[model samples]
Target: MIVVTTPTGQIGSQLVHRLLDQDKEVRVIVRDASRLEDTVRERVETVEGSHDEPGVLDEALPGAEALFWLVPPSRQAPSVREYYLGFARVGAAAVARHGVGHVVGVSSAGHGWPTPAGVLSAAFAMDAELGASGAAYRALSMPFYMENLLGQLDAIRGPGAFHLTCAGDLPLASIATRDIAGVAADLLTDLSWTGQRNLPVFGPDRLTPDGMAEVISQELGRPVTYRRMSMDDYASLLRSRGAGDQQVKDMTEAFAAQDHGIYDADWATAEPTSTDFRTWCREVLRPAADA
Candidate 1:
């Protein structure tokens, strides 16, 4: 059996379907089993509880060959590091206890950077804790997600623009979540690969926010632009949207790290993954913008 966490999320949902397509025996730990589609619910074994809960993974991990792990975002946590490490520690203990053979985890790019990177730092800590578990591990180290633009669908549709704290003219590496799912599915299914390593998943194009806007305009057939917001203004916006103070602060630090090139190390050396920005914009964003 293979176990998946956050099975209803964008990446997890896609990963689950891909695993099913391969005829893999799958089980998922989810908060609400009802949120899964009727067809999906009928197919997989369901462990209905948060993965971080005391006994949830204990119930799900036994006899599983491999596990796909993702820490769901939590905005209410007091400290970002503690919040992420809490989940990782639980997952590590479960993996060690059950003797699961392989584990694949969702993580960010800045694993060994010298500076403190807030949420990115938290993810690095997660990788460390999980690596200590006896299971063979693969940490999918990802850069910026292109799907993050979906959060600004309203801005793109209404004012024909998107906003971010990064420099509009500086190119940054990014990947579609679907591609990340594809990579994870491949790793989880093929348990032959052993030991711990970071797999950098990046899209073919390194596009600036302005360049992205140009592609979005071409795909959507509307004039869209990129607007750079100050870090202070970004924090204010997050706070206005009801994000906790520490969450806002951590996010701000993450963006600051990005601005300082936290993703540059892996991006410079890694082979590009399957999806490109233009294709993602045409296939994913265009449809969302139209809707």
Candidate 2:
């Protein structure tokens, strides 16, 4: 049996469906089982609990062959690292205690880089904790999530314009959550060999935010413009969205780092996914915009 945490999240939800499609016996750990739809809740054994609680894991972890573990983000935490580390420490203990052999963890790009990754520091910590756990682990290093762009859909549909903080045609290696899920499903189904592994999954092509706007424009059959927001504007928008000073600073630093090619590192292997920005816009974003 494979147990998955955060099964209601974008990547985790897709992973669950892919596993169920392949007839893999799966268990999902969700804080509230009622949050899941009727069909998904029915198909899998639901361990209605949070990962932070050891008692919950004690009941859920045992007898699982492989586990897909992820620490979901929370705004209420003092810091993302503190929130994530608490869960990671407990999860590592659970993995060792339960004897679940293989573990696949969702990590961000540039996990082991020496320099500070700002917002991505939590993922680096996850890689370290998961590495030391002695469980067979594969850290999937995902790029900028395509879903992140969904936030701009309102502007795209209303004013038909998108604004970004990035400058100078920054190359983006974005990946769809569905692609990540498919890969995770493959890993759980085929656990051939693993000690500590990393997969760099990229989309079919890389494009700048302006280039992305053009692609979306073409796909939507409408005129769309892209403008770069100043640092001040960016910070103001972030603050409006409920980000404090530290969160705003972290986001700004990560964007600067991405521009400087800090996050562009070699992975053990590259799994190029099929979903390009144009196709994603056509199939997913466009419909959402029209709605």
Tell me how many residue pairs clash in candidate 2: 0
- lDDT of each residue in 122-150, candidate 2, tens digit only: 77787778777779898888878888878
Score residue 211 of candidate 2 by CA lDDT.
89
What are the lDDT figures for the candidates, one per model? 0.92, 0.81
**Best prediction by lDDT:** 1
Weakest lDDT window of 10 consecutive positions for candidate 1: 241-250
Q: Which 10 consecutive residues of model 2 have the lowest summed lDDT? A: 262-271
Q: In angstroms, what RMSD does candidate 1 have relative to the true structure?
A: 0.9
lDDT of 1 by residue, 1-291 (tens): 999999999999999999999989999999999999898999999999998875998899989999999999977887999999999999999899999989999999977999888899999999999999999999999999999999999999999999988999999889999999999988988789999998898999978999999999998998999999999899898889888888887898999999999999999887899899999999999898888
Instruction: List runs of model 2 lying over 4 Å from the truth.
Output: 267-269
- TM-score for each of the candidates: 0.98, 0.94
In TM-score terms, candidate 2 sits at 0.94
